[model samples]
Target chain A: MEIDLQGIVVIVGNYGSGKTEVSINLAVNKKRAGVDVKIADLDLVNPYFRTREARSQLSEIGIGVALPPEEYLQADLPILSPVVAGLIKNPVELTIIDAGGDDAGATVLATLADAFNGKSVHMLQVVNPLRPFTGTVKGCLKMRNEIETASKMTINGIIGNSNLIDETRPEDIYSGYEFVKLLSQESGLALKFITVPSNLMTEIDVSRFSCPVLQIKRQLVPPWKKAVKLS
Target chain B: MGKVLMKGNEAIGEAAIRAGCLNYFAYPITPQSEVAEYLSRRMPEVNGNFLQGESEVAVSYMIFGASAAGERVFTTSSSPGISLMSEAISYIAAAQCPAVFVNIMRGGPGLGGILPSQADYLQATKGIGHGDCRLLVMAPAGVQEAVEMVMMAFPLAEKYRNPVIILGDGLIGQMMEPVEFPDHLKSEPSNKDDWAINGMDTRKSTERNLVKSLFLDPTQLNDNNLILKAKYERMKKEEIRYEKYNTDSDYKVLIVSYGTMSRVCKTAIDQLKEEGIEVGLIRPQTLFPFPEAAVRETALKEGCKAVISIEMSMGQMVEDVSMSLQGKLPVSWYGKCGGDIPTPEEVIDAVKGLNV
Candidate 1:
């Protein structure tokens, strides 16, 4: 299926919701699709697994990545570069901002409120039903409301991403689809897409999903594994 | 379970839960916040309790309260936060409460930078708290070893009825490593019924138990101190752990290192050996009940001329290395503070400069 993701896409979720992995993969996917892509790492909370960690890989793919200064790279203090506003203001074919998880990380978006004004930004709440607080439809809606309030932006779409690391299965994707589908209905948001590991793509029934499937290449891996391992 | 890649902080948190520590109380701090974030999710799924306390000081007491009731509990923090909890840590030590604490240490004297550092070496071992209290500090070189050490921390704490610390540098906490939660490390916590203060109803005993560190009487306090001293002595006898690389051979020089710095030393040692330098390393796994005997024996080797202490701190662990050798051999130091780790090549240069 052809998934044409465009314009300014802001990805936000709770902690460990695979937002960074999704953002990294989205940038690569969009770049491979022959679109000009630039990703902004607005995650001021988490020091690990930020989009900037994959800066070299993204740059190699001809995708632009804006991050804090070299000195403040590892600091928890928020130091959003001025270029982030520029990227958001005059975005490429597709500009993705990988936000930090939870309200604490989403608050940084408030600083970019002016730049995002009058822009067709598809603020999507990425939901991993496996994580805490988002396990139920009510829980997911509450989190969505919290993120909207904190970022001063409305989330217009839902992205279902659920897996148990190397133990992920076809059923996990299908079950997670059902959970996020309910979340979409309750929150009055569109179902953007569900991510499946590239290897597991053939195992799942494409007809089971109403939205396009984004083939995920696990890039944000821990160092112990030589490469991303898919069961 | 099969091997999976995980960050050191997240892995440590999962290891604690897998080790049957269901209660976690900690405040969010960099280089170690993933531990709290991971547990905040996993704990509820496993029917465990997790809390993000207002501050490190409050979290320490929360751990103390849960542990006092005979529950296995733990917390994680960096240098400045750990220093904030030192008062409660001393109380937990004096009260003989068995709990685990993980310090993914960063550079410090104040609110230092948040990169990888081992500046807490002195604070962790020598003067963690105000009183003459000691923590059984275990340092792990990698994420896998960090997992094992955290799993073992609970049992050691119970065995001696004292607080045990898993001391790791921020690199270990931040880096991703492929690790398998070994089956051998998975076990139930020991019974704390003998001394726990779970009230008379819960214990089903006529006598009530009080767990407190306060003793206003001078003579009684001294006796308590003596008893604590004896337990520390027992730990020194039984809990010392170290790893020797190339020390089995009559190597020319001895390098003392621990935690993440030890791994760097190992890399340097490998390169030096390629050039036929024959340098050796002694990595102390337990920093408090330090491998002093192992260090002394290795340093006193007939062919070993000098001992070098390499750490992320300016020169903290060097004191321990110097004290261990007792002037039998010249003790030297090389380190970088404020979240800067020496590269393997720099370590090689230092060893070559020693002219061993």
Candidate 2:
């Protein structure tokens, strides 16, 4: 069930596809499984939800997290931190870069053409059928083209992140898995992983999934929901 | 354990891993991209972290994050990329976050050509970013030094809680040579629970941990700045390191250079010596916390009347030489900018023109 993934694993998805969430969960899961994991917060276009936002949690779990300098934390200024150079030199297990949504967000990787020289990087586009891009085959291809052209690094895999937040059902998971399987075949992207609601894991036929299944837990719960869960 | 033939850029990458810098972030820049490409696969074997960031600007910040958590972290870039990283390096310096950075220096103020050049001398030594910040600049003269200096950078950074810059021009980065890695220097993880912003662990202090660059009050910032300056001054007394060649003899000209340029100077000096032209060289191993006393003493010595500062930039370090000489000896300058490397024969010609 585990591939010796010691190189760069880029996580890409549309705005609400939960790419960062998947990245965070994957990093923790790998690190807990005795892998030396480091997460690069490459999600520059979006600020609200970034892999770095869970710095404290990642650090606590023995996962190294490289974030852009604190000055760029909240600033919308377009500058990749020098830490990327460091990351390229870093010798760690499972370096997951949380890239922004679509081509606009992914285009930033073009600046790093030098580092990608002679190296094969896996850029996985996360898909959610509930989202506009995932509802049709053409929409998925359009998103993939945008990301590939923007990143300047090819998209080698597809991550199916089907969910309805806390309301995810087992049937919905089966439907989503099928939709992504078709998308993966059409787009020629290897079906990398499928994400499932942690509570519904017992309901689904976990053994049926050919690739790994990651459990998604919202790192950032809204204040209203936090109070309800707090009790 | 054995001397392996490796490129300088790859050596630096391996040395950082040996130094226990398991966490790294960076964006790719020309001439130094091999460092990133090498680590991408090596990190996985070691179970380390390697990430190509959105830009050099964000990569430096990522170093800040990893280092702030008390883990050994590092980043690398070139001239334009380093320019983007200056802002974060300043913050790392001020916060006293022990981080390592390698600048495989290339040419220019803009999109300089991708040739070997040491055009970033002033930026490396004179604090590229704002405020009274300083970095420990270690200049590697060749591939071997590049590997050794990186191994040394980790402990030095941790001990001082400061950022260390490995200044090697593109020549060293591109050149391949045999490097013997020190077996004893494989670094271990440091427990910075006292200062690191690790989430509230009761094993240490419960105070709020903040890693920010802002200090609103001028006086408070000024007072801290003064302390930092004092630290730099103390560093001069302890960390100022350089290599002296043929200074025992009454040499007519003294060549001053660092990084790959210094190696070139050494070659030129050897060539001049073979030709019966009495000359010497002062190769600065540490650019910042410079070997000021050595320069002053060497300049003051009788018969060593002229000093020439040769570099890949338009003589950025020449200003420092001017300050070091201070009329005691006539200090001149010569350089090749925009990625062009000066030949040993050209340096000899420049030396003849200086007429020490």
Candidate 3:
């Protein structure tokens, strides 16, 4: 298993689109590969279940984390920090910017227009075919344009994060890969990766993915798992 | 368009782009509104981000969110908005996130008038948070300085991993002048994949990554604070930036000032020089980790009678001057508040009152 997307890779989706879960899993996967990694929790748009929620585990893996400023950690007014600019201007390989959801969440990307001037900064939009505004190609385009407008950056790539969590199937990823391929051709967005549940990976033909396949483990424990032993 | 005359606010926007920063987040505010207005259109042309947030509070946090994801984010506001951002600024510092804050200061206790003022001197330089956090505060006097400081701030913020403030008054924000943008040299933003929470992949099988600012254990917190303090101390050695005006004379009066007040002091010093009075000025560019040693040395050598601290506020910077002098010189303080700028003539009168 190799999560090779290096430096900062921003994983963004519409609200409740499992963007944070992808981000958390990505950081851990990369860190486990013996690569120096860091997870910056920039999801100030949402108050709960941000990447910072698992700071203890991330720190345990020896991966650095730069979260929203301490004062507004709970306040949640729109968490753009100066340190973000500093981080961009001097990135430490694999600097993943987990943007806010939709155009509104993507709006924070505009504040980084200065730094993105030259770099082929890959802007990826995660599409969950199951989610509304993403079920059709037109909706995807609109979401894409909105993200571009708000981020003030072009959408260079797409991630198929189509899943049903507990009920995720290999078929969903294949259909998603096909759907976004049409989108990539129509809208000029390269289908970068297809994400699936780790439990579902063995069932899916990994070779079918022309792009990379990211097997994500659920970071959150179900309420029932709360009573389980640590070991 | 060859160098259109621009206000300091407009220059901030232009300079940000020139500094290789195309992203700007801000909400409308009196006096400094031009920053948002200018960047709103300019950003798109450069393929940059410009968003008018719902409020100053939201706007600053938007900057936080953007910056955390590793981008050069900035937000502009007056005193009130800055006050709202203080909490976020502290977080940015604690989290070691780097971004720029443009504060076009205005006079006030609450909802101060939309006019030029430098009352936020204390707030800008001093730690804005409860924990141990010190920001790199840059005070820009003119539109040129404002633009230059903003360009400089990007690198400074990255170098120290701290927030930098372009602490300007409303006058600088509003006043128009000819300006030149920097021939920005592009540099790669560091490789922070180790900490940037971009996405999960299969190749690297692992649990999850977290980014936060909470240290529970008392000893651990203390250790973290010590590490932060050491970083600040290193900054004092490496990033203590300033500019001196006419200090080469056998001047008895050393006028200590910054931002717009420094310009006023410059004018005052020139007039005094014309009148054959020996008066010099020490203008600090970096307000935090201030040019304390420089001012103290000037007062110490040749027996300068007074080091007068002039500001747009009643006397925020005077405290720095007082601390720096430490009984070596009688530190006099003079200034008006609430957008009332003292003319050069009045400043001379202040110098004469000291009778140095």
Best by TM-score: 1
Clashing pairs in 1: A223-B176, A224-B178
Q: Mind giving the per-residue lDDT tens digits that candidate 2 earns over B256-305?
A: 88877776677788788889887888888998987877887886777777
Q: lDDT of model 2 at residue B94? A: 87
Q: Write the per-residue lDDT of candidate 3 for residues B61-132, one digit (tens) a residue.
A: 887777777677788888888888888887777677778888888887688666568888888888566678
What is the lDDT ranking, best to worst? 1, 2, 3
Docking quality category of candidate 2 according to DockQ thresholds: incorrect
TM-score of chain B of each: 0.97, 0.95, 0.93
Give the root-mean-square deviation of each candidate in angstroms: 5.7, 20.8, 25.1
Q: What is the TM-score of each candidate against the true structure?
A: 0.78, 0.60, 0.59
- State the DockQ, from 0 to 1, for candidate 1: 0.17
- The runs of at least 3 residues in candidate 2 whose Cα sits more than 4 Å from the true structure, single-residue gaps closed, are A1-231, B184-191, B200-208
Candidate 3, residue B89: Cα displacement in angstroms equals 1.4
Q: Each model's C-alpha lDDT? A: 0.85, 0.77, 0.74
lDDT of 2: 0.77
